[model samples]
Target: MTEMTRRDAPAAIRAIGHVSTLCGVVAAALIFVSVLITCQMIFLRAVLGQSTVWQTEAVIYMMIGATLLGLPYVQKLRGHVGVDLVPGLLPAGARKALALAVLSATIVMIGLMLFYGWEMFHLAWERNWRSETVWGVKLWIPYLAVPLGFALFALQLVADLWAVATGHDDADPNVAPEDRRH
Candidate 1:
């Protein structure tokens, strides 16, 4: 293992990181769109005294999509909460081992989610499922986000694992910089 940063990451890892950044941007856009729709819905219902049909359902789907699709970006930024007390106490070699183990476990879990998510999406598409609401949006469209998000998330996890294995990661965040492996 050697000391490295994202700039030193392999091309594939960097590519994944780029995609994660794109996802983050798109997630922010989705949130913005949801907010705009909510405002419009409020205006129509209150000021204009008009009944809204699709606004509520659309907002819900957009929010869920934003959350799922934002996963890879969050992982890329290491924004998720972590408990690193034990890793911080370990020596460099053991710390690296722990990072590998945790990353591997997470990848496997996300892989499962991707698999099942795709299955659900496939079923919805094949069955031509639609929401029962007045808007009657196609279920597959919203469900598509699930598998897509998990897949990107899994890719990000793989990139993270690569970083750890290659010593590109500052594995134990709780450790002092001077104490970390060089």
Candidate 2:
């Protein structure tokens, strides 16, 4: 690789890493909001003898959204479950190839997810679908998290692939030497 290209790769990786981190923060906030709403719902039911309307549905959507949005961040942290036993036994060259193959397969899977997710979100939006619950909240709004999350996840996967292919796997501080092989 040219010196300039090598220099740019790490920089690009860092930028993508920042985006993943921001997504993590957003995911955390969504969970926090869901928790707060749940607490409020409990208080309303127990103390005020009032039934909740949107709280339950809202919490469910937010929790799902949080899980979706947290994907890239989890990958970034190498928090996803992985077995390094096979890769660990391989020579450096073989290990690198394995990493490339695994990363490539992951990217393709996430891309498929992104495509279908977008399709689902688009259908819901075009049909003006709404939840059947008392809240009758718009389905597209929450459905959007599907595509958005997968897109972010694919981006992170591409970054990881690039790092591995270019011998810059250390771009992510969370990546240990053993994890890099996988």
Candidate 3:
């Protein structure tokens, strides 16, 4: 890709990244809300002498949903844990090749997760599944996060791969300029 085209190539990907970041922010807010709810539940039970029923389960579900929904944002930011020793040691060409290989593998893994996650969500929805708890929330509601998050993560990976392969982005954004030399 030419410099100009390469620059423009990432516009779409950047838009998606922005959306993923928004999701991350929303996930953080959800966790915060869950924390507040838990505190309220505690105050109600301990201070006001009331029984708590839904707070615990609701918090658990919200936390799980936040985690699942945050996957794409994490991927977009390259926030996932990774050992870069091999890439760091390799020459530039080799590093680029290795990065492409790793990104391809990740795309495959996330694709599988997206596929199966959708199946699980569909099954739950079709069966009208509900939690066994007295709250009895629909199982598919929370399960939707799995497929949605995986799909977004996979897309982000694809975009990253495209950027790298097209020379629009550095394979290792974390590596300093001097360290990239042979």
Candidate 4:
């Protein structure tokens, strides 16, 4: 990508990435809070000889939410694990093509997830589903994250494909920085 195009990539795409980053930060915070709560639960159970009820269920839900909500941010940062040896050996044109192909496949998979996730969320909402646990938390609340996360991930993937096609993303999509020198 030309320096000019890099500077000129659509503001919308940049905005989406920024939102994804914010969501990721929130996910991290949720995980941190979950850990703290779990510790508290342990203390109450072991140290104080008190019964713990909601903590375990809450922690599990938070962790699941965190994982789902972090997807877009991970994609935005290119943090997902991938093998890059083949792309590294290929010429620039071939590399770009491969990147596009991989991104396209990712988009398709995420898109499908988004669709099915939404369906799941809707079903839970409509049926007033609740967990079987004593906490009995609404299932739709957590299910909501599934579609939302996949949708954001799909959007991020589209932005990445656009960046690659426009030369805004000059680095090989498949290769990590540390591995690039090899």
Candidate 5:
């Protein structure tokens, strides 16, 4: 095949990156909301002798969304921590195989999550389930993260799979943990 062009090499990955940047925005917003709510609660308790009940739950769910949705982005950026336990001992082809296996497992896991997440969101939507707080927030409020996050995760996984399948000697996520630091 033709030598991969600049656009070819980074298309899906850049798209995933844009989406991850969006997730980063959302995560920052969620964290900001959490901080605001905490401060609000403290101010309210100081002034009015009580705070809103739903704010606590709202902040918690937002944090969860932020964290899980940001995971794939973190993975993409090499921000997440890990140890080089596997690649330390494996050979080249064996390392490639392990990389494929890793990508495949991620695909399967994300696929399963997307499948079950759809069902869960559907059930919540159909039943009009409510949150467990003073406010009657819909259950799907927090549930949105599952499908959205997993779908984005699946996209990133595909990018990873493509890089691996292309047999690139040097690619993202291909370098073992040890090779990275050295």
Candidate 6:
């Protein structure tokens, strides 16, 4: 297939979008759980004079997971704010080159995150790190979310870079609101 056609390929683009959508759903669920936990913490503190020590940490981890996990979805939704002001002045080719550069930089950054996160995960596991809380949930488990999210984000960024470099815009329109997909 031609480069343009390949970039716009529905199946390929949708596959990437599906990952983003799935992550978004996970993020949403985590947010909901976090809300419930917050409510529980509030009620217990007010009425029972006690709250689970792990609640705050759990919320923090969940929020982190939600943010990282939701990144690809936000990218899919074209919700990221970009200063295209300067690019607008350039020719289409130059603009796309800039996009490619941005995507490449993103991949490198995420790759580093994934690599260091893996190292951290290994260290945490080796040391059997536990949160300083009653529940003592394994710290490593929550930290794994970092690498997982980075991996998925890297994949999405590659897809985006591929599209930009090839001058293909095969992104799904339905994934994001029409007005927002620009």
The estimated TM-scores of all candidates read: 0.92, 0.89, 0.88, 0.90, 0.82, 0.85
Please give the distance, in angstroms, between residue 152's alpha carbon in candidate 3 and its true position after superposition. Answer: 1.0
Candidate 5 vs candidate 6: the TM-score winner is 6
RMSD to the hidden true structure, all candidates: 3.1, 4.2, 3.8, 3.1, 3.9, 4.5
Candidate 6 or 4, higher lDDT: 4
Worst 10 residues of 3 by lDDT: 173-182
Per-residue lDDT over 1-182 for candidate 5, one digit per residue giving the tens place of the 0 to 100 score:
11432245656666775787788788888899889988898888888898577777878888889887886776566465655577557776777777778779979988998989878988899999997667878988688888888888788777767766774323334454444421
In terms of lDDT, the best-performing candidate is 1
lDDT per residue, candidate 2, 1-182, as tens digits? 22444466678887888999999999999999999999999999999999999999999999999999999998888788899799867777778888889989999999999999999999999999999998999999999999999999999999988887877664333344644333
State each candidate's clash count: 0, 0, 0, 1, 0, 0
| Models ranked on lDDT | 1, 2, 4, 3, 6, 5
Which pairs clash in model 5?
none
Q: Which scores better on lDDT, 5 or 6?
A: 6
Q: For model 4, how does the per-residue alpha-carbon lDDT over 86-156 read when each residue is reduced to its tens digit?
A: 98788778988999999999899988999999999999999999999888889999899899888888988
Mind giving the per-residue lDDT tens digits that candidate 1 earns over 15-110?
Answer: 888999999998999999999999999999999999999999999999999999999999987788898789868887788888899999999999
Candidate 6's TM-score: 0.85
How well does candidate 1 score on lDDT at residue 20? Answer: 98
What TM-score number comes out for model 2? 0.89
* Candidate 1 lDDT score relative to the true structure: 0.87
lDDT of 6 by residue, 1-182 (tens): 23445556567666887898899999999999999999999998998998577789899999999998888888776677877578657765666667677778889988999899888888888999998878898988988888888888888787777655554553321122232324
Question: Tens digit of lDDT per residue, candidate 3, span 134-172?
Answer: 989899998998998888888788888988777666455
Model 6: lDDT of residue 176: 22
Clashing pairs in 1: none
- Model 6 misplaced stretches (Cα beyond 4 Å): 1-7, 170-182
lDDT of each: 0.87, 0.86, 0.82, 0.84, 0.73, 0.77
- Candidate 5 regions with alpha-carbon error over 4 angstroms: 1-8, 167-182
